[model samples]
Target: MAAPFSAVPTPFRVRAADRWWYGNCAWDAFGICAALHVDGHIETVCADCREPIVVEVRDERPDDQRLLFHCLVPAARWWADIVFT
Candidate 1:
């Protein structure tokens, strides 16, 4: 078995589309994504086809965070049913 909390490998880093493809395989997948040293990182995908279409990231202001998203589908403005607790 591997160490409990080892650093993420370079090969493990993938784009949002790649991550979705590998993650939602015939089997199953879940987890988290972390940028090595980027700030205000955000990603989005089309809800219908589950395709990644947007990604925003930067190095300045690593602590600052923001996200902007919208859905093209009518009757729905947000892609996923986001509910902040």
Candidate 2:
């Protein structure tokens, strides 16, 4: 697993704890902030429209709702192809 860093490019880019990081997914983006124990800012894009989206994190909680974390892969099968997930 990439943990706070993604193995490949993704829409999830994060700036937290005074550093830049990549996330495996949107959920992992927030997870990065939490793991660092500091506020964060996430820059991403809408999956459907390709529009810019920004997420603010305070106390490790997302402060915006412009984006939703939707996973097509089931939790039980994520390991089958983690990069694709």
lDDT of 1 by residue, 1-85 (tens): 1211124332122233333222221111112223233232233455469766444334433223464334344435322532210
Model 2, C-alpha of 69: deviation from truth (Å): 1.7
lDDT, residue 66, candidate 2: 65
Which regions of candidate 2 fall more than 4 Å away from where they truly are? 7-9, 65-67
Candidate 2 differs from the real structure by a C-alpha RMSD in angstroms, to one decimal, of 2.2
lDDT of each: 0.30, 0.83
TM-score of each: 0.23, 0.79
Cα deviation of 62, candidate 2, in Å: 0.8
- Candidate 1 clashing pairs, residues 3+ apart or interchain: none
lDDT of 2 by residue, 1-85 (tens): 5586787777799998787888888888888888888899999988789999888998756796564677899989988997798
Q: For each of the candidates, give the backbone clash count.
A: 0, 0
Cα misplacement distance, residue 34 of candidate 1 (Å): 4.2
lDDT agreement of model 2 with the native = 0.83
